[model samples]
Target: MSKKWSIAALVLYVVYAVGMYFYIFHGASGGVPATLKGTVADPQTFMTERELYLSDDYSKIRNFLFFVVTPFEWLVYFLILFMGISRVFEKWADTKWRLFKNGAYLFLLNLFTTIVFYPIDIYRYSLSKEYGISTQGFSSWMRDYVIDFWVNFGTTLLIVLVLYWLIQKSAKKWWLYAWLLTIPFAIFMMYLQPVVIDPLYNEFTPLKDKELEAKILSLADQADIPSDHVFEVDMSEKTNALNAYVTGIGGNSRIVLWDTTLNNLTDEEILFIMAHEMGHYVEKHIYIGIALYLLSMLVGLWLISKIMPWMVSKFGRVLNIEKVSDIRSLPLFLVLASFLLFISNPISNTVSRYQETRSDEYAMELTGDAEAAVSTFQNLAKAGLSEVNPPWLVKIFRYTHPPMLERINTIARYTDKNEVETEQQAE
Candidate 1:
């Protein structure tokens, strides 16, 4: 009976996977619109068009997908919970009722910990204790988490409420109209996020070293990137990760470096990292990334709308929810999103890897120091405990950036090419 049920479940999962794939990849009537094509002609106009298209498409699809996948998600969660409880019961000779009781206790315990203690554990054990990283102890970490949770959750709830309101009040062409309504809110969020959202998570202060700041400014000048100041963020509050990024658009744009990164890396290495970030800015990766994600969300929503009815029929009763608006339905939408994303993983990763390679090329060109970049790559790999080499399939399916060895080899090749070109020019 167990084997039979397992087979049945497997068949259902396979069907879901196929349905999800078609829904995401095929549901869109056409590719990205021609108007939205290429890099932004003007940043303001580009942002406007992008937000309009995204808001409209996302609303329609989100409503559809939310209704479709809510039930299946509930079923999966319940099944996993049941199986885990059953295993624990078998070891203790507990009756079915007793097993359930214990399971309920354990579930609540874990949920509470996830809500409360897990954040503390992550900071104390994972972030603060690490060497060469910023030291944020438990109290500070907890304070940050509370602030972040409320800020993020409130923002999300507000967005959802607005979306729901749009769905209920607007006509079928609501998405088109909704975009115009939501653009101001979107822009406000984007602008406010760097100043308000980020400071809640980490301390942002001006980079203090005059000489290093001058060097970075010189590099930025060479790259033709206009920026007022390079600020350092106290990122050691979270983890021992080293990162630098360029944020904002147009005049609002700035460079942010993690304090941990600044502490651990040499000045030249820091320059190379900044160069990589500048490459992202110069290449307009942020704009391109936002556009791609917006498009994906639209398609994903469309697919979800198509699949909800069948999903609800199969699994809705188990969740004790009959309607899509029960709030219980939210998990269902998330599951469908996850399932579709799992299948689309390869395509998405490939796009990211390609962009990363382009950024790497840009960084190398800007820095004119392939060896320094290579060393920085090696150091990052070691510090992060990243696999030195991953299998080809894993690289294709899972990796966002090229593997460490591939990046090193590419840098070496570029260096050799540059050296040969220089010698030829001298002759």
Candidate 2:
């Protein structure tokens, strides 16, 4: 029966992979947009021949790994359950304090999985280094890796312990209870992240360029955003990639620019980028995102509640688990949750892309600088070696923001529209 399940898992993943290949490479909508033809938004303009070749290679491998990793993780979970590794952890965790014992189990489980996944993680880092994306030394990279492991382990341990406690309290409706708790917990994390969690990995300080800081604050003031300061993180030490974002919640919220961005972009281009991020704040994308997340979790956890018992009843022996509330049953729960999340990628990405487009439009309106916006995106593509036009399935599965081609073309369209409007007003 375990063998049958394993075979079924492999077959299902194979079918998904085959479908993905055809959908990405041979789908009907694969081509440059109508907006880009004969325009400066050509892909050829974005990168040198050597850089383009390197970017294409990097994108293909990254996309391939995206599909492979999820199924691999699911299978690893199954293997742990089938091989009774969870039971071994349970034994090692035997103690008087149930929470402590569960923590031990979680730590052991995470340690095991970390070891199993280390090669993939390290290889990803190596790939970034090879592509000139990452500048950190291997030892520094390893330090960050260790920090990430402990952080994730601690977070998972806390969440899982609460989940199990909820299960003990109400086996039938624990998912509902857990889902409710998730809202406040998520908000708490958001509030704490910028001040606590983020500082652990990188140094963030007030933007040192007082002139640029004043410009950014002035932009914020015009946008009616309460921000009085701009923060910059020293990312040039670790990465060549450029990024800026608004993070945290309420008073904790602030705009942050990567030092790489400040170093690489002109003042006008930086303002355009900053305006784009400020759009997210003005339009309340953060709140909307939180609401959407809760809604998805509400439905997903409800489905898990129904499916977990059936699995436990039917394959309890094969999976070496007795019941849904058993801590050892975590691997099965994770497998189900992950599978659901994987299949929902396209839906989530569609919503994200829409939000990003709206933000882009808002930025164009606020900045009224089409040339700056265009140049900013062009520089972004060059800096990151980004593939401006990727496959259809890649857009659906991987793209949260519009492709660079689409963004630059949109700026062109916006420019033309604004010029026509100005002429009409004069007439």
Candidate 3:
């Protein structure tokens, strides 16, 4: 209903198109390699081959569908549906949630919106299943999905209430105050993510293999991180993908490996992976990442402050809204936020990619094992079904880690053990 919202949406779509064109043709990561020096190995083995592998025709289709088609569908079809549900159901002209308070209305609106998004989500999950990327059963996935929806609904409703209250209180300066508040709230959420949120779906325990745990602890010791224990999550119960990462903040932080990672990868490969995870802390990427994102989000909220009043002015009367403080106009605000998020994706992904690059370098330097790094990626690609040199379009939007070929090449370049040893000896 708002042309201001429509304009923001148009800009997002146009940028997406341009991004696709440039990414596919020019690529985001510069210096495209002429060839991959390594060999392709069987998916079951952690061994490397002399030849490199590319996405097969099937994989290309999967990539296209996942990265391009899915988002495009979200933009064109689901977004409209999403906004319509928000606009219509937000009023609650039909029913009530027990007491039927404003929070209750917000809950229905949010729940409806999430429900509208679910079919598309299920379809995407189906796509993942088809590609052998997900082993989650339909029932189990739906149960998790429902749990996530309720958790998010409560949190979002509270935030929406706070935001509108702020809007009412300040009228013109609410965005500034909200931005100030967001910094700590976001950090708190990050601090709680591993402890409060992650355990809901996955069960975590101390890493069972003492030899491997000791190796990990030794790596942590070398990194000067006081991590006493390494953790393993039973991810094999849900999906076949392999991963290991560091999470939480302060004393709650843990280095977590998926059971699948332990089962599928050798100690050497897992060590390389653990080193990569530890690199984030060693290089202070966690703090840096949060700072970068917080700044980006601050800028975004500033933009929202500038744009929202314009949206209110353009459609205030038509949408039956008199001012920016009206909770009824939250749907329009959310649409604008979605557009901003779309526009920010590339920038955010670029920052993440750069940090990942730093971690990869640190891992290679710390582990002093080029063979392990290379094989680590090879084994991971096998488990995750990641393509070497994923299409540039997919790479720009979807990849958080550097491409397999690029990382392999970087690791391969770290062949001089003397350099690593020299650095370690100095340390």
Which pairs clash in the backbone of model 1?
Answer: 61-301, 64-305, 65-304, 65-305, 68-308, 70-332
Error of 2 at 122 (Å): 0.8
- In candidate 1, what are the lDDT values of residues 347-377, reduced to their tens digit? 8888887788788888899888876786788
- Candidate 2 lDDT, tens digit per residue, 186-250? 99999999999999899999999999999999999999999877899999999999999999998
Q: Cα miss at 110, model 2 (Å)?
A: 0.2
lDDT of 1: 0.61
Clashing pairs in 2: none
TM-score of every candidate:
0.68, 0.95, 0.82
Model 3 C-alpha lDDT per residue in residues 350-403, reported as the tens digit of each score: 888888888888987788877778778887776666666666556776677777
Weakest lDDT window of 10 consecutive positions for candidate 2: 22-31
**Candidate with more favorable, higher TM-score: 2 or 3:** 2
Tell me the TM-score of model 2.
0.95
Q: Candidate 1 clash total?
A: 6
Error of 3 at 273 (Å): 0.8
The residue pairs that clash in candidate 3, if any, are 38-50, 38-51, 39-49, 39-50, 39-51
Candidate achieving higher lDDT, 1 or 2 = 2
Question: Residue 245 lDDT in model 1?
Answer: 82
